[model samples]
Target: MPLSDLRFLALNAWLKRIFNADVTPTLISGDASFRRYFRVQHKDISYIVMDSPPELIKVLPFVNLANAYSDKGVDVPQVIEVNAEDGFLLLSDLGDIQLLSVLNSDNVYAYYRDALRLLDKVSLVIDNGESGLPLYDAAFVQLELDIFSDWLIKRHLVIELDEKTQNMLKTAFSFLIENVEAQPKVGMHRDYHSRNLMLQNEQLKVIDFQDAVLGPVTYDAVSLLRDCYVRWPDALVEQLMTQHFEQVKSSGQLDRGVSIATYTRWFDLMGLQRHIKAAGIFSRLKYRDDKPAYMADIPLTLEYIRDISARYPELEIFSAWIADSIIPAVEAKL
Candidate 1:
């Protein structure tokens, strides 16, 4: 149903009263998430209307953050009118080009350097106690990891693992949790990557930031560099990572001689957890929503977790178990 319907009758009526035209909702990109965005054109003026089903989605946090960032002069979408009670929000349309699509090996280094500059700007604003987002604490990190057990292991994999393997898995998660929890928490985009970044007017306009949290600083870097949607060569990833480290150091985001080894460990482990979560999420989408396209990407996500986890000698015991037991079993089934 479009916004020109009974559900949005009050909203449409309100939009007419406010914006003064016949507004028709046009669907924009739909993602795995419950929220939806639509374009509304009245005369030559255009806007985006976010339709978030109230029962399944919450809007206040995103609203608050958007306003905060807006106040701080960040180029986020401007909120036009909001029906908080019914989850309808009218916003300024940023445009069609996503930074993800514009990015390539040719000028990736330059573009990413600018992107890091933006992150640095965000850090400065956020660090001044302006943004009051929650941290991805030990509990949350552990909970994210549990998505694998609940969604993948039990739900998708549908296995009754023997006690020994179960214990080993538990130990693996424990190790992962300890390392992940130890990193200094910073404001995370939560979904920071090329896809959420739009190239509007040759500027990187960030979106999909409703779930931002304070997490390991390296998580965003890894998410941006080793994006699940796009792959880059290892050398390029390292180059970008190195550039980020240098810039953050100059920007005072890092202290001199912070353990590079530990940061790499955090990035690798975080990728493992995120990749595992994504694989199961993709499977769930296929089985539950009949969206089989997601299933096509599961193999790459699994390979990422497997390949990265295997390289660490310390992670060998755990990776071998996942490789030999968990993934193979899930792959055969899902």
Candidate 2:
């Protein structure tokens, strides 16, 4: 990964060339995406260079969205320089304040409330009657649900549901989709979890927001509370959810068209769908992608699916089947 032969080196060089800034490059940590990053230091000056290989991930969308957020007074990483052709960017360092490093059981409320306030602010800033991001529409949701079927059911289980079971699944999915479609949509940070929230200067700073989109109002909230990397107690989640519903309502996004009970139901069902999607995605990551850390989260996610499915008697037969047969079998090992 030397500068001369690196795939992203040229792109990094091109961005540096714009500022005529000489840099001493050092590799930096990156998350699960195909993107990588580096820290460059030269003449006592420091900047973070995001090395997103162009062939794998586009730069314009991230750049444009970050710019849009910044323009709206949100604290996004400043784009000091960029080379769109090669997918490299020199950005202002947000500093060493990842939320995970500072979080604990006691301070979750304070930090979460702060995060919620920021979310509310962003919702306010972007409510210009149009969302610039792509909608996580019906098609996108269907694709996600299919991942659950393909990876979790077919691949992991090594079996197919019978016609009766399959029909029940289809019915459950129809309810899920109908519930998802009925909710009000907004610009959502698709992966707004603890790992993505940074703590720059004791204030929560959002990152990994490039995947932001127009999605369900509950998507990010559930992503936060019922995180893949962390789990909170059900009581706490419910309390915070009540607080969040109030915030959303006061923010003027609530139209009387969707009843509160209906919205709550949508939120529950949508969470069930997302948990299933996450379980499948995590399982696939371990089994197919050679990333094994995710396998540990699968059981908890499956349990969530069982718990939620039972909460509604309309889903009793299906939930009972999953809880009694599928989940117990899978839970023993996965």
lDDT for each residue of candidate 2 in 190-215, tens digit (9 for 90 to 100): 88778888777787677777877777
Q: Give the TM-score of candidate 1.
A: 0.89
Model 1 residue 299 CA deviation (Å) reads: 1.7
lDDT of 1 by residue, 1-334 (tens): 6545665566667677777777777678567777778788987888888877777777776677777556665677887787888888888889988877788779888887777667764443343235467777778877777766676667767777788877877777777777767776666777777888878888887777777776776777878888878788888877777777777667666776776665667777887777776777777776676676777677677778778889877667777877787768767865
Clashes of 2: 1
Looking at model 2, report the run of 10 residues with the lowest lDDT sum: 121-130
**Each model's TM-score, in the order given?**
0.89, 0.87
Report every candidate's CA lDDT.
Answer: 0.74, 0.76
Model 1 misplaced regions, further than 4 Å: 2-11, 124-131, 286-292, 325-334
Residue-pair clash count for candidate 1: 0
Task: Give me the candidate number with maximum lDDT.
Answer: 2
RMSD of each: 2.7, 3.0
